[model samples]
Target chain A: MNRTRFLDSSRLTSALFWLSLVGIVTGLYAAFIYAPNEKTMGVVYRIFYFHVPSAWVAFLSFLVVFVGGIMYLRTRERRWDTLALSSAEIGVVFCAIALITGSIWGKPAWGTWWTWEPRLTTTLVLWLIYAAYLMLRRMIEEESQRARVAAVFGIVGFVDVPIVFMSIRWWRTVHPIVFTIDEIRIAPSMLAALLIALVAFTLFYLYLLIQRISLENVGHELEALKQRVA
Target chain B: MDGVKKALWIVWKDVVCELRTKETLSSMFVFALLAIVIFNFAFQLRGDERVGLIAPGVLWVAFTFAGVLGLNRSFIKEKDHGCLEGLMLCPVDRSAIYAGKALGNLAFMLLMEAIALPMFAVFFNLPVLMPSLLLVILLGTVGFAGVGTLFSAISVNTKAREVMLPILFFPVLIPIVIAAVKSTAQIFDGVSFDQSMPWINLMLAFDVIFLVVSFLSFEYVVEG
Candidate 1:
């Protein structure tokens, strides 16, 4: 019965995965073909579809990690630790995508590959902070000790992220205005395309999170079985 | 209240140990001094002409790197003598150990900063000994040490203790460093205190947030 239930869930996941694949293809088509080009940035502006959605999903992933951290601390459940670790790893990847896409968009838009603009700067710092989180997890050998310490870190690190954003925002204001994304008005079709991309990327993040968590569980079981045989 | 007093005792214990050994303080001070010297040569600044430009960056970089050295010692010393487990065994609130260690780390960082200030002034040929600059230094160090102490405890149990401290330290320290560097640069530029109030306020916010969060979370890090 348990095996049958597990297979049922696996079937659901596979169906959801296929649904997301379809959503992503549609999102791409809408982004590239449906959305009209801007007068200023031209065709290259299509990267915004990928850029903004990736950043949104990345932030969402970190939020999950933060909640998982708190849950782990409160309940001492190993499952929460698995969720936090997996989400953080995925978060780092999406954050890197946000950064790379932002840089690519910046190159033609601002004529520089990188700028110390507030959002980009904060995102880069966010990337570094979570990267450090993963590295900290790697350094600890004991399972429970690693979970507890990493939880504390995730909680404290999340609190600091807002302060970091604010400070960088203020710092940027004191300097000259390099370029402003605010000036670009989102046309209706562009907004539609952005919404499609957001939905698709969010589904993609959920799919990845589910897959990673199950893989971790399998790995945990394998470790246990190996120890039992030994 | 008992927790507060116990925490104070933790601070006193560290102070006495540090005074007798002076090892951590001396190393931190020397390391910071060397960094300042390196900065002086690295920038190749002539006189006070470029001192304002480079002084803040140089000062903060020195302080943070040196601050990590002191923070690492805060917990490692306890771990070395097995005092850490003993402290945990005590009936007192676990956070007292955190408070004590953070306060101790804060004091060492401030002392290093105090001594380094004169050297910084001497090397850059700038009068950076103002009361305002000291305020910025204190706020920045408190935030840095507050978070650093917690992470140091967490890092000490890790394999790569030395590398782990800075890796964990620098990223979370971005706000404090930014606020400190910006305000310190303004002070060196001879900007009045009021001009740097915004940055100072930001530092104050960072300090309070990290202090509360670290104090609350320290138990988990240390107990684990």
Candidate 2:
């Protein structure tokens, strides 16, 4: 189904809301209780179980913003703009959570709260780009014009994300992150927990996205209704 | 072919206007100089090792911020002076206007860089005037202006535009900035052109990608 009919359904919306809630509670248990403590990094390493998933969702949200933007530019529909705006706002929040959790994990393991690592730098850049996208949207008063401008930006910003990641990856002077999460062999149980967390977060993003888009749609309808009354 | 001609004509128009006033160039040059000098003072680049360490970052910092100053002017003038409406009245494709503005911005940025590179050498007593370094600068500037002109157009219509341009521009330009700085540093370090190939290739790829993207999207940006 197209986004409007799909996201517009009250049944699907509530289902997503309740399902995501259950998934997240289960995910918290998977992250904290089911996953084993690591040998080198110990308890701090558990943050990755959530932190990595948050980053994944943030990236997914920006991709949605990109697709939504392109579709809006093509279709000239308010619904696509709503999708873009809602996704941009949520992406920034998840990006922030990932950065914060990463920092929290970094302090105990890496001995520094922040370092110019590629993933960290790329994520920060992503955050700043989307934050600017939101800022650009807020600053413009004209609705359709705002959509056009913001869509162009949304396309450009997403295109830049991989390049941003690559350039920083090449540019970093330090040795690769000392905590080689790669070298740690994931036991089957840990892998299952990680899988559960990823699925849960993905569900949560969809639920949040549908809710936010509905709220925006209501706001659009309210404005229309107000104009009709006047 | 006609599109290129139209774009070049727009470029010519911008050049003539810029040459008449000397407004954008003078400010860009001076700002770049101040940035270079300030960086020189901040880092105290006496040793070759230290200069190699910090020069790329400082040089790009100067160019990007100064380059942005020029970029901000590219569209703001058309916008503030009501020239944008005039341009829109012309029987031209929006991409032509985009190309014209992008090229015009590129020319001004190169001119400013041409001046600043020598001054950067003098302030820091470094070998800045190498052929390889110039290529890196050109690639970097093309990439910068390619995206910069598009974004400048986008920002001029917004409120507190001065604040918005940098905010919206830099984060997206981070990849280009990193590539430019790294390539420039490698060239300065007496590395072979072959050695800096990866960074050079990165800049080239960025230049190509964004130039095409900005070109395609320019229509939506200007059309109401």
Candidate 3:
């Protein structure tokens, strides 16, 4: 908004860009070389490093959208709507990645490319909800109304995720439960590698979210300018 | 006016309109019947022992598809007739409009199911109209109309219009589909009523949650 804040934001973006790059490179090494092969599953278990973080970041981004939706409705701020839209797009991407990686892992681990496991079903439902959010955005022609309706959906869809998980879990769940309250149930090296990947993926998600929000702001300004000229 | 009174008035108006035109019920009923007929053909349901295995799923699928038709008409008619503005202008709470539309949709869905289920039973020779099944149907339809009414309002205003309703409605309605189908199967399996209680509870919970969320966020949807 002001000169110094603008400068600080630019500096922050570049710093995030470089940090994510470095973190991802380090994460790759950690996942591949630092972590020992899993005894039962061997190399197929390597996908877990990326799968867990993508899933985590996907859920994290939806939380951003959910919070943004509430704030947008309360404040009626353009920034909040922009934040929701941007996060939803990123969330969809990461959610898809999580699904694909998990499916690939399922083939080797379970001898099936897909299963109605609780976690898998929840992710798929979340993915469909995200798609609906984006589709809702695309279908509305009016800017403010679009934002309003989308925010409504964002809030409602995020709230439905737990209900979806619970209903499906009650139906069935054979997905491996790796983490518990007390310990993660893995070797220390594997845990360390997972931590690195999680941090790296999280940083990468932040960088993308900031970039997308700024891009949306620019698009809004351009639309305003075009209307004025016309 | 009070919300309930106002909502009932809206429902009264919609039901009268539906009664006069017979438009919404006809489309929904026809679609539902056709779905059952098709299901009968696909699954070969004549005196089959395994009908219980797949019948619940088939019944739910048919009903939900038909319910979407009923929901799509719930708001599209008001908006298309330019009556939505008048409804918005009324001093009543916008949630009155939501509750009214949702109630209207539920009525149409239930009526359609009442006929469709008996026809399905006769054609397939399955005993589907029991008391427990009726309760399951009521719970499922309430959740469908509750959430579907909000989506109906939102979707009818979108670029794709009525086509968007099912895309948005069905995915979020997964819990209802699962719980409803499972409960129906449980009933058919002659399981104890207590065993099916969780599934019934699930539909009841989804009904409450979606209805509250739809009520809270509804004003934003109708406001200009």
Candidate 4:
């Protein structure tokens, strides 16, 4: 809570920016050069390079919601709310990318742009649920009220994500769950590329999260400034 | 002695006021009836094939929308007259206030469903008045009210409260709706209780989870 500690946190932002640059470069190289063309879908399957990683990060965002929400409710600190909001926003972005890239990948693989198969449908539902969370935050004027209610929602909303994910496995669905890691069917080079992509995307997510937290801090400061001026 | 009596007194005051005015009940009943009518026209519920598959969805949809109306009114009256703040100032447990409000909202919703169910059966020419189906309706209503009351308290404080309640309520209530509709359909198909137990269990789970969650979170929501 010290002012110096708070100000020094900005250094982490620069570190993330540099790390993300390296990740993007490595991800692009692996996707285009290193990974082999998938036999069934051909070139378009390469979209998994970005698509799968984005999906992983989206789920990670909700994990932040769980931890940050619990802390906010327990400590009654505004910082935790800021962290939750940042994570939710980043989660939404990654979810959007996942949907779009999945669609792009689907066109060649599934021969259609869209289908209500469990994977796609559940992802769509996850998107709307978090979007509703952000909307609920906007609908409340008081910061404390917004934080408390949204934290409660963040916790409850996260419980649904796993259910949504499992709905595909539980019920019959058309979307195929390809690339089971344990199956070991994919080529070694392709697997290597995917590992690199995963690392890169995770670093990218960290970078985005830091940027968002900084922006939120600035917005909070601006609000405080306005209050003082008023 | 006085605190318990005062809280009970507030509960009675709300019930009597609602009885005399009947604003919540009438609005919810008429809204539910209209929703059923709209569904009837929209789906053309004449044939047996269409009616069987769509009946459960139509019934629950009506319940959800009508329940939203009831939830919105439950707090608006208290907030309008500043009775909520007065209630908060009392020495009684805040959970009592949540319980009383939720129970009142549950009563209004059940009343609306009671009217809607018979009308739905008559309109669709479906026999939904069976005991098993009625039991499913009652259990589903508990899950709905348990969560709806908590979210209503939260949403009523928001800027666009009327719109906010459904958005917040629906996603969290998805499990309930799915379980309710599945079980109702199973009963309508003449399935035995053993066949329907899983969905029933799921509904019970949802009710317990939300009831506990809402009870614990109610204080944070109602706090100034």
Tens digits of lDDT, candidate 1, B66-113: 888888888889989889999999999888888888888999999888
Give, for candidate 1 chain A, the lowest lDDT window spanning 10 residues: A1-10
**TM-score (C-alpha) between model 4 and the true structure:** 0.91
Per residue, candidate 4 scores C-alpha lDDT tens digits across B1-224 of: 55456656766877899999999899998999899889878878784756878888989999999999999988888789888899899887777788878777777888888888888888877887688888889889998898898889888889888888998888777767777887788787777878767767777877887788888878888888
Whole-model lDDT values for every prediction? 0.88, 0.89, 0.87, 0.81
TM-scores across all candidates? 0.97, 0.96, 0.95, 0.91
Deviation from native of the Cα of residue B104 in model 2, angstroms:
0.6
Candidate with best DockQ? 2
Model 4, runs deviating above 4 Å = A1-8, A164-185, B1-11
Give the DockQ ranking, best first: 2, 1, 3, 4
Q: How close is candidate 1 to the true structure, as a TM-score?
A: 0.97
- Model 4, residue B134: displacement in angstroms? 2.0
Model 2, span B1-224: residue lDDT tens: 88899999999999999999999999999998888778767777664667778888988999999999999999988987788988988999999999999999999999999889887887666888788998999999999999999999999889878889999999999988888888887787787889788889999999999999999999999986
Q: What is the C-alpha lDDT profile of model 3 across A1-230, one tens digit per residue?
A: 43111122767888889999999999999999999998878888899999999999999999999998998899887788888998999999999999999999889887889888778889999999999899989999998899899999899898889889989887773345432213324898998999999999999998998898777767767998999999
Alpha-carbon deviation at B186 in model 1, angstroms: 1.3
What tens digits encode model 4's per-residue C-alpha lDDT throughout A1-230?
44201223667777877888888898899899878887766787788888888888888997897788888999887888888998899999999999999888778766788766666767787788888889989988888989999998888788766544544333332346543323435788888888888888888887887777778887777888999999
Q: Which residue pairs show backbone clashes in model 3?
A: none
Using Cα atoms, each model's DockQ against the true complex is: 0.85, 0.90, 0.80, 0.52
